[model samples]
Target: MPAQLVWFRRDLRVRDHPALVAAAEAGEVLPAFVLDPALERAGDARTAAMLTALEALHRATDGALVVRRGKPEEVIPALVAEAGAEAVHVSGETTPFGRARDRRVERSLDVPLVATGTPYAVSPGRVRKGDGGPFRVFTPFSRAWLEHGWRAPAELPSQHRWVRRVEGEAIPDAPEVEANLAWSAEEPALERWHEFLDGPIDDYDASRDRPDLDGTSRMSIALKLGAVHPRTLLADLDRVAPKRSKAAQRSLKRYQTELAWREFYADVVFHHPRSAWHDFTDALARIPYDEPGASFVAWQEGRTGFPMVDAGMRQLRAEGWMHNRVRMLAASFLTKDLHVWWGHGAQHFLDRLADGDIASNNHGWQWTAGTGTDASPYFRVFNPVLQGQRFDPTGDYVRRWVPELRHLEGKRVHEPWKADDGYAHDYPERILDHAAERQEALDRYEAAKG
Candidate 1:
């Protein structure tokens, strides 16, 4: 029997998968995964998370998720020759590395490499403006996106006729990275999603900003690994919206906007591949960035002495994730206060985050640095102290992450230096005065404009 070869990458799950379905449409299906040594040897937090998720894929496919390590160019064609696959099938990749790998694989394969779907809900490059160009700003792009809606999720394949006796390397264990694995696999991922959808989703709008509270859906890692599909989530949202109270409906709408932002960044990277390594807006590129010196180390180690920035950094170290609001404050402190380049902060985040998506992580740093599309105002700096006070009103987030300030009471924990009983608990002093750095940042922006 002629077998269909399914080359799995980010889209790990079987249900709601177009590529898997397309591949299975042939006589028999051979599931395969390649460990690109270039990606695996990075030995970062994300690498471990991906391995954990791949384990779930192993179980899902009943040991048929073929694991091989090498250049995809060599491994894939060799697998095809051995399995005698009629065609190599995949959900096409969107990132620069992914695109390059796909091209090379297509060239080497004797049979056609059929691309049925992509990792994105609406594939990047599919939704563009009335003109042929991609949308730079988000609001118009979102409206167009709604108009250019994606198809319903593809049904899972009915049967699995595993073509046995295939020789490939064992699925390797996750690397022994210093960071702990946060989101393990699709099973736990689904539990978290269903829990969030059932209970806390109604409060997502009002409470997503508070780092201390579990107000937001912890689905990013799941989304990153394709443990669950965005279309599946969207369909659930539609099913529940009518039954929800008006307030809950508003909250769900707000949460939907957040998902759309993810797609927007993906689209942004798809059209402007250069933005991955360079500044999206050139106007601010002339500003000189400070060297990653002692101050940079302080920021990385959660010793910045600004409770909000420190707390977020500590949380990242502990959980391999940080709250969305806290991540912004942390990124802002790095770019605007420390005068370090956004790339430095972005790289550090990619090294740590379990949900470290290239498009979202890099563009998020750029957005905060005011160097990317729809940039935050260049002169606007996040006062880490005030951000802590405003978002984490009770100082719970600060105390939770920065245990050094646990002795302080209530929101006063946000400004430890100002406390009457100011406990000088071994926490480092604020690296640079916020006022001083804010002015310094503005001056550089002025110089860049001039």
Candidate 2:
């Protein structure tokens, strides 16, 4: 039987994989991954994580997973010819770059390039409004998404025959990163999902916002890399939690909505590809943005003196991941308090985040900056000090990443300047007065609108 080439992209796993199953059913399968130079633009943390996952996948496939380096349009055709594959199967890519890349590869291949599924629960453009046009806002989109439900997770192939005739390059070494990745493989991802389902998901609604607590599922990187599918998570949620209790049901629903938010952003990008970098709406089109300067450096280095903002930035530096709530606070501090362009902050995040996804990261930044779909009002400037005290109440979250402020116990850690020994350890002073900047940001918004 001729081999079917399975080209793994974001959808990396063997389980619940439509492309993999389709390839396996066709005949002997040759799994291949390409290390495209263009896609390596993400920072060291994402690079390291992707490499680690690729290594794990190699082992799982019993060393039959072929690793190659080059442009996919060229590399995939060569692999198909070498393997004598009939067709190349893949999980359909939704991003603008991905779609364009696929078209190039398809044009290059002699055999068919069949795309079976995508990295989404319901593929980006599947859930549309009654009029058949895309929904601009999230609430309506999410409602339509639920009404147009996703299929159950695809079943794993009953058997496998991996082709090893083709010679391939060794998986490259991962770049060094400070954050410790607990797990990057398919098995560990499933384990984490089950663990979250066992208990913590019940409190996700109320506790997800508290950065001081270990309250999040932290499956973002896994999802981003396709270590686990959203459908698998959704299936598990239905099987275990919804019937546990009323409160558990609410948490389950909240978690589901959060997942939907991911899909919603992807949908937005699918419809308006330019919005990936440009503002999704024109409300902030005229808003003047300051150039990144000394204050920008302090914000990035976690010395902004707004404990929550500093802690969030430092956490991102050390761990390559920041709490979701803190991510917004940090972004707000950069865009609003520093009066810098959201693009600058968004690019920094994409560079640092292990789970940096283009659609989600950029859109989330725009949302916080009040320039994207369903954005917060322009005047809703987040006060970093108050946000810290409110979300990081005990201030342990701030102390965790900002060691210099550890001396200030309890909530005082959030407002170190008020504490007697706040700057005794040489913690940097506030870069700019928050109240002054808040008004300045507002003025700029009004001026831009006028």
Candidate 3:
């Protein structure tokens, strides 16, 4: 039997993985992961998480997982020849970089490169409208996505026939970034999913907005590494939700909508590849952006003096992840308040976030920057102070990360400048007045729309 090359990119797990299953069906399988220099150099936190996930995939294949370092175009074809592989299979590529690489790899190959599945439940570029055009907005796309529906989780292969002829290198150790990496890997990821599905998933809608509460599934890192597929989560939700209370069922549905948002961004990025790096909307492109200076540095270092934004940025540095609500707040501060381009903040996020995806991270920043599909209007700036008090009513989220303000108790914690004696001696004063900056952002938006 001709051996099939299984090119592992994002999907790095053994269970419910489509590409691996298809390769197994065709013939003996050679599992390999190519570490692209671009991706490998991303950052210590993301690199560490990916290396850990690769380790899990390695163990799943009994150390037969091939780890090559090079461009996939150069690395894959040589491996295919060395192993005498008749076919190559992969989870379909969606990002522009991934797409270009796949096209090159396909061109260089003699055998057919079969794409079996994608990281998303409904892969981008597939979901469309009645006009056969991609859905630009999310609500209709989400409704259409549910109508389009995804397949049930694929069955895990019962056995493996490893064709380990071509030797591959060792998966590297976690890099020295000095930041804590979130999520150990596959087994831990699955464990987290099962644990979330058991209880907190019911209260997701309630606490998902509140960063202080233990309310979210924390499945992003898992989804990023493909330890557990969205279909698996959707399927498990189906199995367990039927017996759940109505409120719990609603929460499950709410959580599922979040999943749809992920797919929606993927769809958006797939259709408008240029939009990944530029504004999706033309008018917003003309908006004047300020050069990032000390203010931007302060934002990066979590010394912005806005409790919610500061806490969120610091949380990102400390945990390599931030709450969803906090992300919006931080993005708004950078783009709307500081007038720095959204791409700067997005790149910073990509550099840091373990779960960062080009689709979601870029589009999310565009959404806040008022430049993407169904974007927040430039006028509708987020009030970090109000946001902190509302979402983190007790101001615990801020105090948790911005410990300098720990002395200031309760709601008072959200506004340290409001302290009767000014900001606690160590903590910096408010970097930029939100009210002044809000007007500036609105004025700039008006001028740019001209």
| Predicted candidate 3 versus true structure: per-residue lDDT over 236-294, tens digit per residue | 98899889999999999999999999999988888888989888888676788999899
Superior candidate under lDDT, 2 versus 3: 2
Per residue, candidate 1 scores C-alpha lDDT tens digits across 26-59 of 7588899898988853436778888888988889
Worst 10 residues of 3 by lDDT: 176-185
lDDT of each: 0.86, 0.90, 0.88
Q: How close is candidate 1 to the true structure, as a TM-score?
A: 0.97
Best by lDDT: 2
If ranked by lDDT, best first, what sequence of candidates would result?
A: 2, 3, 1
List per-candidate RMSD values in Å. 1.4, 0.9, 1.4
- The residue-level lDDT of candidate 3 at 121 comes to 92
Off by over 4 Å in 2: none
Q: Model 2, range 1-450, lDDT digits (tens) per residue?
A: 879999998987878898898899889999999999997787998888888778888887889999999999999999999999999999999999999999999999999999998999999999888889998899999998988888888986767899999999988888878965665668888888888888998899899999999899988988889888899898888888646899989999999999999999999999999999998889988888889998899999998888899999999998889999999998999999888989999999999989999999999999999999999998999999889989999889988998898888899998878888889999999989999999999999989888
